[model samples]
Target: MATYRPRVLIGNWKEDACLEEERLRDFMHKRERGELLIQKIDKLQDNLLKKIKLSVTKDGFVHFGDTVMLLNPDNKSSVENNPGECSRLTLAVNLDDISIHSAISLQAPCGVSATKSVEPMARNTFCILSVDGGAVDEPIRFGQNFCLGTTGGFSDQMLYLASDHKSFIRSAKKSYLQQVFLTDKLSYLTCWRATFLDPQLRLEYEGFPVPANSKIIITHCHTNRGLAVPGNFWVRSYFGKEYEVVCHTYLDSHRAEEDKNYWVIVTANPSNENGTMLDRPSPYPGETTKNEFHEET
Candidate 1:
């Protein structure tokens, strides 16, 4: 089924977004648009946003089943005048693109039915209700895993984060939300671990409920590779230009490539038991909850 990212229409590029924005490399040098998105985030202090309670966890961390948006940090949104255009880059997995070279044949001794080679059209993620393109938010998290589906098998037809040498691109390992699956798919590749932001304290904080709206590193459990953006790399696809996301090692010193690995987390639009938006009571002495403000950031 077809899907649309809120305000980021899949194909067309507008003057406001296209002209005003720089190609990935150019923007890195200027850093002009990124700063704008940051200012917009600061303006999120509006009374309405401050009043709502978005996270369900008492501690405000995301829970196992929570639907959320995994966004690129320090990138800009496509919308004109959108605050993130200057402050952040709105990047996420593009289900429609990013394919693997060859699917791991499940019929082999180590393989399972789900990993077998299939016709290209057979495995596309159509009508998947989770994270349907933008941060309005909704991608269900499984036990440390997020599921993406294909018509051929099931939602379990995963976007695994394992290391594979058979990639169509030069990138060594991948978080396969791309168009095709590759050979060498192993059970361990499907595991992704969310760790605390600080590297020094990771083991102690691993698996704590991931905080909503916080920066995170989605380390592929099997290879210890961090999911990363490819230095504003761009490629042409059935859609317009698409940015590349890959599973990359942080180099032997373990500090290189850290710059491209940060991702921001935002939860889905949440509702209460009766299916209405949840209203959070303000804990501050003089504050009161009010209607929600729905501007995109």
Candidate 2:
């Protein structure tokens, strides 16, 4: 291929070979890639997200890699809310819950796809990691299907999210948490539900762009459960204190618990730019040439 020249047919009797050569030439010239500098690849995860002040965005949008806090704005819980405390998602699982540990054993079946290599993927759970230590920011689009990361926190701290469908074999209702990671293949395991504004709008909102700062849902696209925070489920961690973030659907009326799943994408860096009108962004279908992306700030 290095020696092959474009449109140069040096011989006859070459039918498919000529076409393939042309295709390769086009591929070599037509590849489009964008570079985004989000943060230092080796930067320490000192729970930087916790230091971000909870504030609204001016542009009212979120783009990829824009540091964000998945805030469950619902103050309905009886638990006390400190003025400066921000309870974001974390990888801390209830160590006492044996079922979760067992659930981790069965995670090999999660996110299985035809193209993805079949390998056992353990839950990102570890008792040593603090409840609010650090985590990757998940994606969302109102009235669109998506995914998030959970279990043990992702080490890469990049795009998209993963989850553990706890008790799929034991209970009828499945629960999952969204954890972020970089990947080329997308499947139902990464699919989370994001319905905001109006459910009725979904019918008319296909291909309609969603702005940032809009409250959206983070749930598995195929399950009744959604990403939720146990308001009262607090855990003492290496860092003072943090909230135990769980992915359980409200056993009662699903509609009543909508507030629990509410999340807003905030600007990770609000200096010169807010996020963007990209809260509901998706990659090109069948994209194979490096699908991972980050903010070009």
Backbone atom clashes (below 3 Å) for every candidate? 21, 17
**Model 1 RMSD, rounded to 1 decimal:** 19.9
Query: For residues 1-64, what per-residue lDDT tens digits would candidate 1 score against the true structure?
Result: 3254335656553633564465665756535553433333333212111222223444455554
Residue 17 lDDT in candidate 1? 58
The residue-by-residue lDDT of candidate 2 on 1-297, one tens digit each, is 334443455544265477778987766654432111112211122222213222334454443233334445533451355444443332321222222233212122222110111111122211111112223232233445533333223343322344544553432121234322223344655565455434444566544434554455555555556666555545443233445455565533323344455554433334424332233243454552231111121
Worst 10 residues of 2 by lDDT: 112-121
Error of 1 at 54 (Å): 11
* Residue 63 lDDT in candidate 1: 50
Global Cα lDDT for candidate 2: 0.37
